[model samples]
Target: MVMTRAANIAFKPEHKITMLCLSSSGQFLSWADQSGSVSLASVGKNHTLDVKGNWHAPGTVVGLCLRGQRAYVLDDVEGLFCVNQQGEVDWHVPVAGGGFSLHEGPTDMAVVDALGRLLRVGYDGSPTDLTSQFEGILKAMYVSEFLVLSFEDGSVKALNGSQVVWNRPVRGEVGESITALGMDASGHLIIGREGYALVDGEEEALEMETWCLNGQGLLFRSDLKTRLTHITPGLGSVVCGFDNGSVTHYKDNQHQELLNTGFAVQSLMVRQNHVVVSSWFYLFGVEEGSEPWKIEHQGMPMLLESSNDGSICFFAGEDQNDWTEPEPIGFFSLKSEARDADPSELTEWFQRPDTEPERSAEEIYRVDETVENLLTEEERMLMEKPPVIGLDSLHAALDDFAFASPDDQAQGTLNVDAESLLDDLDDQLSSMAMMPDEGLFDALNEEVVAPIAPVPAAGEDQVVTCDEDGTAVVLLDGLGSEDPQNRIVMWSWVDSTGQEIATQARAKVRLSAGVHRFELRICDSEGQWSSDTIQLTLK
Candidate 1:
């Protein structure tokens, strides 16, 4: 069975851990607690406890970024500290400037402070400051060859590290904050704020893209404004986890809503084709190319880290000091296909179908009064289709191919099943040979045949049974009710004119001696009509 939820543990208060990180090689799973203590466990060997360190600080450990052998821990009071392989702090850089974001890359790690200063720290132990370029506090930053920063002033800037590349001033004047940011596969930077987008040449503001549960409009109204909580790129789309417990994906310049998490998504990591997100007590693993799946845990998990090698996932939360020790961390094997793969999967909420008509044969066309004039363009263009038997056509074509047409009579070569047609032909030739002087159909023209009505309805039997007095009578059953109150019947007279006659009430009419058409109409008490008509022949 797939392990969707982690087993529960008794609450403890002393060993309360909150954040976790894994080295890119997947050998170590490191965790930090609320008591300013950090622990490293060896997951490769039955999760053997390795070592831990306590960095006494006033505030909590907010985030963790791992590069190689060193880990950078961001705290609410201690700024950012770089710890090495020996579980010792290599250096502690005081971010007294107050930055809410800390990010690490392959070659360097950077932190953006409240003063809009993007301090790039490299392995050489020096800092490169990109401060004078922007006019607002940097709300979020994405680093590649180009560092994309979304500022509180509702603008986004593309910087080649510290130098400005291009900038788009957004229209969100209310200073809402840019909550999440990412670069799509197309390389156009995408910033998710309260409601709008900053892409290419256009900045689209929040325009009620969806309605909230309260029936109020949730507009993408702010430009690159509003604090972006988390962002990850998958396939051609960007998956963003917001402060509202809402996970949204942007594709083809359109926003698709995913899960509506009630709590803020604290950490989001994308591993080999999967997106793993953590909030308080919730962990969700969304297939990078597909949809999200939930993994159950009760106490709110704070930090989520997946194997950079795509082999495992780790979730850490504060373990209380109760008599029963709570599990401070949980492990998931990313490559364990048996556990990750399942046939039954829940669809993402943003993926529900919109209200639209179903596609089926019964709804292909609607017949109405202007059917002739309302022909589809393609049908109207086929006005020149020739009749099966055109003007002055001879009937002899039915038998003209006998000399050269091989008998495909079995497959209906001449409008008849081969066996039956051959049997009839044999009987005809045998009879002719046996009695040459006998005439075929000796009683031909002497038999009277009754006319058969091709189409029949409930009341059609009465119309054709009219007596010699030409009076037709019908019993009104269930008439004037809400159901079918009228029906139409048509009769064609053999020796009379071919005009069709329609009727709703029973009455006698002067007969014209030949075939006649009759129709019936029924209406309910409230004037609602039923739609059944029939055709018959009058002898």
Candidate 2:
């Protein structure tokens, strides 16, 4: 995403910013200062104007959460209060003892009082005594169907709605009361200041090389693989910027690359197809296979948030010669290019002769001859993507396609047994034709129904272990069918977090810990769709 950015002033206040939070709407950023000054900014335009409300609450603002149009804040002396976008105090309630941290759940909010009480609150409602209703819960996070709780001593418990599912003992002895409790990149529970422990998956400290920048006395909010200063979530993979001036790409558990930049990165975020990395004065927009597009920033940005549409981005930082108030630097219209060939794969692509095509011939997109003939010229052009070895390589794959690695090829010895597959496809097709339901044909809207094939079936051990470099490709192979429309004309590959990694049948993915469910939506030529889902667990 190469976006054109502009600089604009957000507000005029010199309060030392302690907490920064972006709203779920992607508009408006609410910040709390050391003096307990809460300000709001509507941040979707070319610039952020001072639409902030006036909140002069005393005492330090310990916790801040913005949901919808209200900002939920907790102050030492002021107590828990809901502030609307207009800066009006919507509701105020005293904290029985004192609250430290605030975590948002799927349906409600959970606050940790000093006495290990979990005070729950609704979106716009006042805080209640949910802590008194529960047992030994200091911090509570209700995720999915599991209620993950962290206690004062760094212990965690997962309860599946009133039933104890799992309990992880205290990670280590703590010298003081728990300061913070939250989840980490691994989907594991973490107790700040005390230590972090993996509650959901097995913990293997895969340490990678990291860097350190001088002067910042901040302890890591979450100490991941390295001293990663910036993080951008990716489909099946994660991009991390380390202090060592290097950008590392990881999938599964394998560390991928060394996009070495001498300057320390402050932020890493994905904009469309590009990964945006920010340094002290530069914002680098990197697309696969091309040099990173660098844009100079006025100064170090304390906070950067872009819209979901990727149309604009706003950063909270001091401009040159001004450290009084956080100015809004907006970048607009970052158009992103859709690249097919993987940038990670370009490391080898460049090693080959310059005259050679960027991708292998086998990578070209292909559909059944029936699909080619049935499609309009425009559809035909779009449908035939490039060099994709979808169905053509099914039989000849053993001889033509070189295995990604020797071990993978050794395991790839098994191919699709086409005979039984065709029989099964025929049987399913016949059954479908005989069924009384006419929904399938009606949806097709075609008088002549060409025989479509079943989606490719998985060979033995369809799920393979992470390769030597920590990448795993789930091959959509061994599947056989004879139905004309059954030829998969399109593919949708989605990761656990709903990020689509690939549109091709085969998915080369980086899986996080625990069970990751991915759904593959395949459409045949006749506008019919079929889905194949798989759950892969990464330790």
Candidate 3:
């Protein structure tokens, strides 16, 4: 048997939480919602949260980093903002694209934009551009005295200021890309869907092996059958969660299975003594010497973070329903054996007492009838007093239907030229009698041919490798399209983001290292159009 408990601290937000970050000391918590609101709170004794300040951003917050008394926010429309504890913006910078990643360093913040421009901003609102030093940064982290950056071409490098400490340019399979990068006590680790590598900073030659290369100072790699979803650095290794509901710790060229949650892991955190894993419906805390405790959540856990000292863990998510909007909820949990507290103090709002009577079927589905519920005010007014037909309106309609001649109406017969009508009928019968039987049969058997529409073919899916510049130029072919009239007048190519990239049948497009999907649309002269899709995998 395992012990179960409710969260010791809880908070409900007005909107769904978009991002969340906890400070290293576990004293301050910061989060952003869908409405572009950023909030900072102080964590007191007994895991209590006291909101200190709140600020609003111009767009949806994508990145949030909490340090000291300031919150660094990066939104989609706005570039970067440093909000102080008094809810005032200290500085602002304009960022162009939505694909920007933000990381906090020891002294400044590092930002990598969609165009691969790297910028370092100091605490005093000073900015430095280091874009020329690197090409297409996929991930960056400040470890020890060096900054480790991963590129789009599956290369990893460490830099000390403007100098390169070391470089590793090992490429993965066609559909495989780097998923996670971190520094452990052993070496630098790079994980992907197909395999992973651990590199130590040293000078060595290459030694090829069946599984992994033995060169470059303590490197290890192996294929993974299951897809990785979440990862976090452990004490001497790394903990990985998979889509198949299995968690494992990878270290020393081998991996040990931790526990299977029987569901895809949504979030993961590793502390000093235990590992906390959250699925869609439950949070599991696995320890060494005792049974793993499970806590049922009222919603799906979206965010999980641990303090630097591994003393407290924060969790937040949203309760989603079919007919209602998502409601955000958050809580914090203390490390096992960290402190002793009363269990009754932690309230579970979703639970009901056993003393309450169960509701009957009729009571559970009962709905009361009210005037406001049945009809709108305008509808009720229309129902109470219906419109009446006026005498003048009836008279106008009768006049419109009156006969044109009073003499015909009195005789109760219609005036007609009977002799001329018979003569016309005789002429029609004479013409029909003179027609050929074979000609009439052929006319009835004739088949109508409808116009054929154009068919668009986007060609076969392609797998292309990037060049030395970390980008590939591939030709999108739509010449395989077919049309009955051969009058295909227009051709359009659209990317996965719904943006038109080309207007010709065959065009070249430059793409970064990743997966890309495109759609091709062709229109003929007769205004008939068709579309098809093609996918490209860039390595």
Per-candidate Cα lDDT values, in order, are 0.53, 0.55, 0.69
Residue 286 of model 3, lDDT score:
69
Which candidate ranks first by lDDT, i.e. highest? 3
Q: Write the per-residue lDDT of candidate 3 for residues 7-115, one digit (tens) a residue.
A: 5434667777768888888888888886899998888776677888999998768688987889999876678998988788989987754426788877777776655
1 versus 3: better lDDT goes to? 3
Judge candidate 3 at residue 462 and give its lDDT. 93
- Candidate 2 residue spans exceeding 4 A from truth: 1-12, 43-45, 48-52, 113-117, 126-164, 169-232, 241-246, 258-268, 277-285, 293-299, 318-333, 336-539
Per-residue lDDT over 1-539 for candidate 1, one digit per residue giving the tens place of the 0 to 100 score: 33242222211236656666787777766666757776545554544445544454445566566666566776656577777766777887776644445776556666754344566777544677774544344454554566667664456666666677666555443333454565554444555555333443454343212112122423233222224567676645567777667776756446576666678887776675666778765677656454455665535566566667566666666422233344445566666542443323322211234558776665567545476687787886686575567423533543432323455434422443567668878999987785533455555546776433222232443335556755333332212222231222222211112122223232223332344444444433233334333334444
What C-alpha lDDT, on a 0 to 100 scale, does residue 57 get in candidate 3? 92
- Candidate 2: worst 10 consecutive residues by lDDT? 209-218
Q: Considering TM-score, where higher is better, how would the candidates rank from best to worst?
A: 3, 1, 2
- For each candidate, how many residue pairs have backbone atoms clashing (under 3 Å)? 51, 28, 0
TM-score-better candidate, 1 vs 3: 3
- In model 3, what lDDT does residue 266 have? 85
2 or 3, greater by TM-score? 3
* Model 1 residue 147 lDDT score: 64
Give lDDT: candidate 1, residue 130. 70
